[model samples]
Each structure stands twice: as C-alpha cells, then as structure tokens.
Target: MSGRETGATAYLLREPAAGDVEGFAELHVRVWREAYRGLMADEVVDALSVETFRPIWSSIARAHAEGAVVDDGRAMLVAVLGEEPVGFVMVGPARDEDAPAPRQVWSLNVAPEHQGSGVAQRLLDEAFGDGPGYLWVAQRNSRAIRFYERNGFALDGTQAQDRHDGVTELRMVRPD
Candidate 1:
C-alpha cells in the first residue's frame, strides 16, 4: 500500500528482496541510533554498524527468497520511498517461553522523517495481521510505548534486560 506522505511520495511495504539487504542494514542501524539515543548508553548506540548487520540481513533475505520463512510466520517487510528503504519490520513466532501470544514483533522502525506518516501503522497491520501478538520495547521509549498502545497493545507487566546491552525492556501484548 502507498500514498503521499507530507509532501514526499509515500513508501510501499513489501517483502524484502536480497538486493535490499544493504539498505535494510543501514536503516536498522540508523533507526536504532536515533530511537535509542537517550535511552541507552552512547557506546552501545555508537557500536551499531551496518557492516555488523549486513551478513545477518543477507541471510534472512536469502531465506525469505527461498520460501523457507513462511512456515514459521517469519517475515521482514521493507518500506521503500522511491528507491530507498525508509523503514522495516521483522516479526515471527514468539521466542519467550512465557509469552501469551504466539507471534512477536521483533522490530519495527521508521526513519524519523517518516514518523506520523502512517508507515509504521501499515507495517504493524501487515506484520501482526488480525491476531494476538506481542512485542518488547525499551522501557524508556515512551514514544514507542504510546504508539503501541494506540495500536491496541497494552503492557503486560513483563520486563527483562537485554542480554547484550543490559537495557531494560517491557512486554506489550495485543490480544485480538
């Protein structure tokens, strides 16, 4: 789906292609640095590098292209404006043993310039579909928490520290 956003031509959300790996990696690092700036340590944010994630994104794209990801309901959707990727979402079956829902939103991000342009909403709708699901968000990311709440997710009182960086995260669930 696509439309004009603000004044720019809006983005189109579609399954990621192998050629999109580099773009996805770059966007992932950019969004994480911006979104987690004040909520996480500078060192941690600075450590985010596209080179560090390119291989992983490439593997996922390869799996997706080979039709090996659908059985697990895993997918990576990219939102492209013109020829550049402005955002992406990764989702799949929940990994937590105690999760209330079977699906989990592993990541959802939009370029700061694209915020409030319905890109995130479209991504969420496509990722979660019409089913119960959950996601973990940084506890201090009030903007994201509010966005999830507005989209039908509510905090389920579950919290944990990210193993790699020790940042606290809270679980939110949408049971519909």
Candidate 2:
C-alpha cells in the first residue's frame, strides 16, 4: 500500500480480522498507556490490562471471520504495517442519550512512534470518514484534541467524567 499523506512505511487499512483480536488488545493498552499516562492517574492508566480488553475486541472481530453481513454502519478499521497493527479507529452509533450526532468515534489511536506519520489520519478516514459526527476526547490530551480539530471537530461545551477512571472528557462535534 502507498502512503496516503504521510508515513514513510506503507500500511494497509482494513477491517480487523479474527486473528487481530490479540493485537488489538495489546496495541490498545499500549497506546492508551502512552496517551493517558500523565493525563490520568498512574494507577488508573497502568491498570488497563490487555487481558481485560481482549474479550471486547474478540467480539467485535468475530463476525468478520465468520463472513457475516455488517448491516449496521459501525466500523472498526485497523492500520496494519506488515504483520502488526500500528493504528485503529472504532466508530458506531452515538451512545449518549442527548448525543449531538447519530454517529460517534468511539476510539482512535496510533502508536506513539506512528503518531505524526499519518497512520491516525488514515485510520480516521477509513473508519469514521468525513461526516457529521462526534467524539469524546480527554480534556488534557492536547495532541489528540488538535488532531480532532484539524479533522473538523469543534468543542461542544459538553463534558463528562469517565465512569472507570473519572477523567473529564470534552465532547467535540462535527456538524452537518
């Protein structure tokens, strides 16, 4: 695969395979730790075990391996560099009762090493696309907030505290 806009190494952007469940768990934990370390409590960030996330990813990727139809608009795209997943994005229907949009970017992350290499942008495009949606990002994650803003998101003045860790998250919306 050719580079979309950045990144020297080529990567393939596609839906996750069943075999990718473990990789997703591992990368998700690693990226979460890197991105949330200083923003959240050390114990909270370090407590995100890969074992806990594996079952969740397994369920998400199960249908892909079973050849099931993906009728729901939900999508989870993975950016794979060779045999490893370097980035990923998960988008689906908004979860909030008073959501700004029907679609939401549930999660998006790129390995710290691939942050500015455009892997995150590519994953965002493949999974969420250019649309009127929303996402909740950590208030202290300046880098991620900037990236989301560059991708057309604007702070909507709404905020929430994570139930698990109690970190405040700001809601950003992309309007139609």
Candidate 3:
C-alpha cells in the first residue's frame, strides 16, 4: 500500500531489496539519533553510525535474496517515498518469553519529516494486520506510547531495563 499526502508524493511499502541496504542503514541511523537523542545519553546517541548497521542490513538483504527466512522470524518492510526510504517496520514472533502475544513489533521508525504523516500507522497496518502483538518501548517515549495506544495497544504493566543502556522499557500489547 502507498500513502499520498498533499505536497509529498505517495510512498510505497514493499519488501526491501538488497539495493536498499545503504539507504535503509542511513535512515536507521538518522532516525535512531533523532528519536533517541533526548531519551538516551548524548554519548550513546553520538555513537550511532551507519557503518555499524550497514553490515547487519546487508546480511538481512542477503538472507532475503537467498530465500532464507530471517533467524528472528521477522519480516522487514520499508516505506519508500520516490527514491528515498522513509520508514521501516520489523515484525515477527515474540522475542520475550513472557510476552502476552505470539508476535512482536521488533522495530518501527519513520524519518522526522514523515513522523506525523501516517507513515508509521500504514506500516503497522501492513506489518501487523488485525492480529495480536506486543512491543517494548522506551518508558519515556510518550509520543510512541500514545501512537501505540491509539493503534489498539495498551500498557501491560511489564517493564525491563534495556541491556545496553539500562533505560527502562514498558511492554504494550494488543488483545487477540
């Protein structure tokens, strides 16, 4: 599916191809910095780089091309606006042992410019359908928590510390 706003050209959501690795990696780093800057330490945010993630994306693209299922059992979908990759979502089997749902939203990110343009919702709809799922979100990221709530997820009272930075994350789940 694609989204058509007033000024911006419509964006298409599709399975990412190997050629998208570079763009995806770049977008990932940019969005991570923009999204986590205030929530995480400056040093942690500054440490993010495209180079660190490019190899991982390359591996994903390779596995996708070779018809090998992602070891994490997730599907990676990218939103392309013209030639630029604007957003992406990763969804699959729950990684947490105690998750209430069978699936989880491993990640969802949109460029700052496209944040309020419905790109995230479109990606969520495409990736999650009407089924139940769950995701861990930074407890302090109110925008994302509200977005998930508006999309039918509710706080499940489960919390954990992120292993890397020790930031708190809360679990949100959608009923089956």
The local distance difference test score of each candidate is 0.86, 0.87, 0.88
- Predicted structure with the largest lDDT when compared to the true one: 3
Q: Quote each prediction's TM-score.
A: 0.92, 0.92, 0.92
TM-score, cand. 3: 0.92
Give me the runs in candidate 1 sitting further than 4 Å from their true place.
Answer: 1-8
Taking the tens digit of each residue's C-alpha lDDT, what string does model 1 give over 25-111?
998899999999988889999999999889988988898789877678886778899888898888999999988998999999999
Model 3 per-residue lDDT tens digits across residues 1-176: 55555245577888878998999999999998998888888988899899988998898788778889666557888899888999999899998777799999999999999989888888898887878999999989999999999999999999999989767899999998
- Of models 2 and 3, which has the larger lDDT? 3
What are the runs in model 2 whose C-alpha is more than 4 Å off?
1-6, 68-70
For all predictions, the C-alpha RMSD in Å is 2.0, 1.9, 2.1
Candidate 2, residues 1-176, lDDT tens digits: the string is 23454546788888778899999899999999999998889998978998979998898788777767366788878888878889888898989999999999999988898889888888888777898999999999999999999999999999899988889999999999
Clashes of each: 0, 0, 0
Give the worst 10-residue stretch by lDDT in candidate 2: 1-10
lDDT of 3 at 44: 88
lDDT of 2: 0.87
